[model samples]
Target: RESNNAMQMVEGLGEDDDLLRVAQELPEPSDLLESDDDAPIIRLINAVLTSAVKENASDIHIEPYENRLVIRFRVDGVLKEVLQSRRAVAPLVVSRIKVMSKLDIAEKRLPQDGRISLRVAGRAVDVRVSTMPSGHGERVVLRLLDKHAGRLDLSHLGMDARTQATMDALIHKPHGIILVTGPTGSGKTTTLYAALERINDNTRNIMTVEDPIEYYIDGIGQSQVNTKVEMTFARGLRAILRQDPDVVMVGEIRDLETAEIAVQASLTGHLVLSTLHTNTAVGAVTRLRDMGVEPFLLSSSLIGVLAQRLVRLLDPATKEAYRASDYECSVLGVDPADPPTLYRVPDGLSAGEGYRGRTGIYELVPIDDSIRTMIHDGAGEHELERYARTLSPSIRDDGLRKVLAGDTTLEEVLRVTRGD
Candidate 1:
């Protein structure tokens, strides 16, 4: 019913081209808040959200300054200014968002987090709303998760054939933990979901314990962590194990307790999936050991780790094929004498940004007996990484592969995997 109401509220609001015009038509700031009917403000907010969804934006930023209000949309992992409004109207806009997300409008001094489920033009969207106090005013960010983005599949996750096959085999195991490691906003959750989807079928029970369930899939049990009631990843994961789940997904392994529980679950005949906030696949093992998961238990339960990063794809229409320079070849580890022809974004497109979409470049390492021995012996990150390098490509290598394949540019690859 709320979704329907949200859909109805956005009805008749201008779309991409007319969103600014609709915002311009908003009533006076004071009048917007004082009016009994919130139709004007509602329409303006609805239009902004609708346009964002239509644009496939991952996040929406509503920032207020002393002189003006700036609304930006994060598209393909890059922020672009979408709309601007008068500074006087910022409060009304922020207040409306709070009301829709069911947050306290009066509580602007403290940061607040809320979720808003809406259906915009028949598209189901789950928005994670966060508000923070700023010098000028309250700033808002909305993470738009389009529930109808369709089925998650490994084949669609931009993994190479060998990596996808390895992932498929890892997730299909009857027991063991498959970890996807990456920094925040690097498509770790999406990759996990795709792995789950790949293995999801009748005759096996799949369950998840997430901080907040981002996407809902049929035939899978997903539980949200409610810290207000002391329900957390560890608690929820323990409960899930009691339910006789064949597969378990913990949103993240934040502490030793959750890591131990996940390790136990994986060892006790459950295929476990989870993520870690590490920059590389080998770093995940080190992070787990640092979190107090015994090296022996990690060795026995860990099956593989996939480290990934999002790199913007060059605009095919504007990209020109060119031979890589010797410096580029050296950076990419390609033989300098015979550099490969690579594609690059020319200066004429999208104001030289020259990127239209993003794809994940991944480093997948499947744990074998040798690597397991190293893990059991309390190997450090450097030692494990040195050995893991022989087993799989590094994240930068994968990014370089994508660059050579013309899926992305060297500059973009370097931009995302600079540290590696």
Candidate 2:
């Protein structure tokens, strides 16, 4: 919903031109996949694929109802219908996707999930395919996992110097659990991979267990979770520990058993990196406790928490500085004597040029002996947050720094941070 509002504020830039360029760069469909070349159906499918890639669309949707089939691209979190066609061609296009994904096209009554690798614009794209039964026909949704997102290291993830240094120290620790917390699509996976990359060593055995392995990094053994085969996160991590690994990356701690195993791994002299679905760093303490992880274990083996959110960066070409408002100053905890500076995109700029990609705003909470004692005593989330403020900077302060540096807008920071 937040991203939809952001995209609605401005329109896409060079949309038609992006599609045209991708179409020209494509080699024949026969070369890319085992499909009949020179067929109109193949041409339409190829055109859609290249166009979606050029726009950096995260997902492509083909929805069929009573009469027409609508094709929409989820660009920057919002769904925009690019092309609409008759229901006649919908089956052919969806079938082509299923073939590439190695899914059973004939069994459309039951929902199916599969993956396809497509080389578009000279880059390999891992597309996650899902098909479900609808009123009139089937709905095909393709989630594109572009490797471009995982290419970033910590230095390039839009974090401040102090926060980055704190993270570096936390990740390099030989033993302890460092968890990244945020909602879905908050770049938690990218941050986890980046932290691992910084401390990754050939001498140390580092392994990761992801739901569906998204990024491919050499020298790292990645296992995909297959519930069908009884290979869940808990089972996978238990197996990985027997191999004598120095570092373990559990994609996410979804359940109590997995969380308990991750904490146990940290206590047993391994650096475990993972993510939690929490809004703030302090909230993680309460969340884990609610998940049945004992408070004593959390305080002992926990290293630090880095809560982050990705906010769209302002276009440097059109960035404009403005004075911070009274409410903004209060929220940032800035002194009125020394007013804080803020930045944003000037009005009248196109959405394409309004903001470029995104940068991260983080709240770094490094646990100290005092904070640990508070946790051990079963402190509430509010108390932990107040105590943590003395040990680290608040997320609001980090957002203000970005606004002062013209990296993002005040509104955007508030949106991602939930105005806390």
Candidate 3:
């Protein structure tokens, strides 16, 4: 009887019209006890959160269409579409989230943003929500920020020992700029956070200027970039410099002004750390120079560059594992006949696992005299790549060495690096 009534109520409502009204007037659970569809939509949202946490997902995206809602989760830097809900149910689900976030229900054409917190298994989790207009309907993205996940160690980041040591040395410098270069989702932020953690001291002042301020750190000051109101990286850096900070972290070096400011800060007795969207570490210098910063300024201000890429890790529990391909072996000049494995599995040898967790493959180059001279002379990416190759092993070699050493799986390395 209750199920019949709720279905009748839904039928009485017009399609996609006055959704808020119907949502506001939803019958109590007791009044519609038998209607599963009439059950509070909050329960379904909570279920999604629970499942996402269980899968260790970092983000959730909900895309609504004329007939359905597609839900995706970003886990370990990979986006996977997991579920879909009927169009009749999507609005209720979206409305519940909007209500929880205290957003305007009637506003569908414009973007809306909000956040919510929840406790699961005695751990507090922060979920950042963003909704934007789409052709069929609104698309929603939620970034799950788990504070309890804690920080990661440098060694665990898949960087070779030599590169790790180089980074360690760079961070210990009293003053200079250390720029991490990579495409987005290359774990640059995590690497910077680890470096910051290493230098964090009670007596020192470490500040950061980020767009959305992804994660929170103890004993460090982080500022969000608000371009709408004029709190950009350049302005933020100016203010941060006036505060007598020992170390400064800029989220990105986008414009020439911000790059100039960061370089200037590094030249003037401040240890600056920031990221650039370049393919390689050496490319960072060239890109900065192209951004109107003089070569001399770069040669003087820049101290080190760490370029990285993410590789996938194979599951140790699986019997059929992965092996480095001939192409990969060729890249590292490793002979398959004389296999000197670093990390391996007992069962061994299978095709890729579609995808796996990501590991960093780094090319860290310290700005020594030779490198400085090369940069001053307008060196290209090849120069940097050649120099980096000479100073350190290729990313493949380091990852294969780690695989042979049993630090990480061969499949995992190949997964991200797309090796053999």
Say which candidate scores most in lDDT.
Answer: 1
**What lDDT would candidate 3 get against the real structure?**
0.74
Local accuracy of candidate 2 as per-residue lDDT tens digits, 143-257: 8888764465999998878889999999888999999998888889989888877777687899999998888777888999999999999999999999899999999999999
Residue-level error in angstroms, candidate 3, position 65? 2.2
List CA RMSD, all candidates.
1.9, 7.2, 8.1
Which RMSD does model 3 reach against the true structure? 8.1
Candidate 1 deviant stretches above 4 angstroms: 11-17, 30-34, 149-151, 350-353
Evaluate all candidate structures by whole-model CA lDDT and list the values in order. Answer: 0.88, 0.80, 0.74
**lDDT for model 2:** 0.80
- How well does candidate 2 score on lDDT at residue 3? 27
- When sorted by TM-score, best at the front, the candidate numbers are 1, 2, 3
TM-score for each predicted model, relative to the true structure: 0.95, 0.86, 0.83
Model 3 poorest ten-residue lDDT run: 1-10
**Candidate 1, residue 23: lDDT:** 85
* Candidate 3 residue-wise lDDT, 68-109, digit = tens: 778888887778777765656666667667766667888999
**Worst 10 contiguous positions by lDDT, candidate 2:** 1-10
Off by over 4 Å in 3: 1-39, 319-329, 339-356, 403-420
Pairs of residues at least 3 apart in sequence or in different chains that clash in candidate 1: none
